[model samples]
Target: MAALSISLSAQNVTGLQGEAKNNLLRLTWVDSVDARGPVYIYRSVSPFEPGTDLSILGRLIKVPYGVQSYIDEVEFPGTWYYFVAASDTEGQRFELPLPPDNSIGIEILESSDRLAVSPAAPPAEIAHGGEPGVNSLSAAVEGDSVIVTFRAEDRGRAVVLYRSARPLKQARDLVGAVIVQPDIASPFIDYPVPGIPYYYAVIFEDDLTRGTAALYPGRNATVEAVEVPQGSDGVGLSSSASIRSLPLPMISLAAAVPGMNAFDETPSPVELSPEASKALEDLEPVQRKSSLAKSPRAFSQDLEAPGGGEEYALYSIMQDFFLKKDWDGCRNALAGYLGLPRSSASEARARFYLGQCYYFLGQPRESLFEFLSAQPAYPDESAEWIQASLAALVK
Candidate 1:
């Protein structure tokens, strides 16, 4: 008799199992199969919709040719379902059905989900002198500057103090103080060295009565500590402390009157460093023309006005990054540019470029959001691009 021949089809994955611990779901499967192709894993919060393509279930992973395990760290509390499919070298895929070993689902219960709802806290009592004072004071290090911002409950004169070291329990620890009128929208920008960190405190005085209160990192002062010095008229005062050995630099408060105690006078303009000045320039809102220019001559006439230095720098950096196809660098630069307050046209342009960068980085969701934000600012220019991107993503 002639020799008999037999062949076997690619086997479906077997012995699949899963266990849930806290917010982690661990899955494992037997590797005894002789299949030689990639194994794809899919997950969903609910069972796949009827007639749903397996590719659209949101691929959780693609295990190597021989690997047979996966772990998912869920970010929220919920029940989740999972499935696995094995593909042969010839592009044939065999999906494994739910295992009899209870390995198809995982339930995560976060601590927050288990807690009972508590009653809301009572409203805070108003401060004396009709002064609501300042609250939600925050400080952050951005680049080489420390930006401080706070919400004022009442109109008042505010001062921000900076120190190199922490434990700023007393006013004497404050090395430099600057006056900031609460009427303005500008934030206090303290320029420090590149690598050093600093602490900050704020004091607000009522414009009518000089009742003073201080605000620290996490808490507000219940009692006023600043008192008007005897035998001196009510004038704005500058306070300072010394730090000889630290690498920090001292900011001058020469315009502040000494031994004065009053919030009557207008605060002196804050002198900004070169970098801060550039940043502020970049943030200045641009005024748009009431009507579009009709001809090339009109456009040329409009261009006669001088442009800001920082704005030019920002544009140059963006162009360079885009031309070089450096997606990450372009994204970061665009983000920094957007952080500064910008005009409507500038904001729209920056957002559009940022959306392009996100798309090139393989993040379609973020790109879609950015495109939507840019659409409102420049509808005529952004409508076509936004529609095309949305259509492609939907398909």
Candidate 2:
């Protein structure tokens, strides 16, 4: 008998993807033939920090070799980041670069309480392939829908189309655009809010899997705001029927994605403010906080109301701090607010305020993170803040 020798070089799962349907989170990836055995999956609230052990995420799943997809029954509805890596026969795993490679993130919305959170069967299957490289991407008005046509480097790969009010600069701009179709065939036809112009961008499943699908605006990524004439869109369907029959969004331009960049998920590294630079002269990077609060702020509105609960109570405390312009107090309260087991209607408000606190206190970088996190809950309300925070950080 001979021993199996596996090379421990840099390897990654190409085409990693995640989609949220109701309460189900489906993840799928390409299994490179070079893999030795099992695969490891990890999830986190924020982007996965480099070099951190997978176990620390507190939710690690190991799928046996040959399994290309897994469905997770998620408990809460909020933002979730995920990454997958192939493991060796003995379970040795190598660290791969985050997002755009073996990593993808999606924000889940609260589903009906009666609708069980049990994982549904794996999604139709991640149709992945094609060169992923794209060219001649353009948008044209088609009756009631906008037809986004582009030449894919190769065909058969699933594409994610985005609609934005402004031109997208890169794939990162995706956070600011509405995902018209997460997994669809090319020549994407979208039923957007009638009467407004939009830009569109197309990204491939293969690019997402290989982390090479980074957006290049006109060259590769960025497009949105598909304005169509106000009238009938689908075949033999009235305007109202067209809006209701399609699974794609028919939301107002402002609702689809706030002002301009409310959901800019990944911003460049933030430079320390002069005062912050001095304050961090020797401080170690453990975790940043403002200060501790004595108690949860009293709830406003009726306690028996649908929106009133522990989540609301905690949010109130943060609001009180925000009202007094107490950035640190608000930040400290946010520490507890985010720990709640489930998300609430106030989820967007809480994050929006925290984003403001960071922005007013000269922490635009942190502000961007909070605003982006808040998008799933309150898509239309936070873009202005995202724009301001981004402008500040960029300067």
Candidate 3:
């Protein structure tokens, strides 16, 4: 008899099972104990019946024979069937089904499902950046300046501070107001002439750019203006712009009759003085033609008074510009008025209006200077303007 040979192979895969969750299909199988090579995993829209071509398309993966489970990421919701066939060291595939094993099917949805055990979780999150805006804002009068104190959370960026005669309510209040400090820090010293009260507000420069910050009274802003002492430097103020950069008005109540408070005196309007008309005519050729050429009657204002000479006419011109809120034109008209002969009353009015022009123009230093010079004529009124100019200079 010729010699006969017989070789043994590994058992087929068993216990094939699947669990679907969150668009993921997890397949599990019992690795054949005798298996030595990789196993072939097949998937299809239909169940795997016996005699189905084991070599046909539908092979999902070839897992090592020792591995027992795999998680398949599903892109769409639907039904799927799976089969796991074990292999021997000879690389030959075993049967797809041998018992209640090696074959399974299930339906999946876009939503998630949980089993007795779950998958590993995702990574944790981390935070970045500091808090925005200002806080703890308060003010006190120190020397000739009001020391404004506050806590700010700035990430090495700039901030803007605003001063207002009225309580600050919105960003719109910033209109026509000088930026007391383009960049700011706490304990800012402000030079405010004693008289009018003032409110302050600070905003982060970054928030202003990002449009996220807001003005909140008593939080980042002063709910009330600080009561500055009767004595202040009356010379200059402080801010991120520097306390010294802004000079407050130095008041001089010179050449005034005793107790003749100008603040209470409301003079009646008069016709434009001939000197004022002549002065307007003398304006440089480049001055605004139609607006500047108007007659005194055409440019009447509340503060006009009867007077004579070039100074009086110049004063009239200043009044016209001032009433129009044309600070630039008013300031220009003042240069001519300042150059003329100084009259006790005429000079007082000029100084007062000049200060008004500078204050409106955002030049606190010059505004304060003129206000102080006019103190003698418009005692009470000049004091108020001076105090306001001083507050504007505050850091």
**Top TM-score model:** 2
How well is each residue in 63-105 modelled by candidate 3, as lDDT tens digits? 8866788888754433455777788889877764542466765
Better of 2 and 3 by TM-score: 2
> Ranking under TM-score, best-scoring first?
2, 3, 1
Please rank every candidate by lDDT, starting with the best: 3, 2, 1
lDDT at residue 93 of model 2 (Cα atoms): 72
The lowest-lDDT stretch of 10 consecutive residues in candidate 3 is 119-128
Q: For each candidate in turn, give its C-alpha RMSD to the true structure in angstroms.
A: 27.7, 25.3, 30.6
Clashing pairs in 3: 144-232, 144-233, 235-248, 237-243, 238-243, 238-395, 239-395, 249-368, 276-313
lDDT of 3: 0.63
Q: What is the C-alpha lDDT of each candidate?
A: 0.50, 0.61, 0.63
lDDT of 3 at 286: 86
Q: Which residue window of length 10 is worst by lDDT in model 2?
A: 119-128
TM-score of each model, in listed order: 0.25, 0.29, 0.28
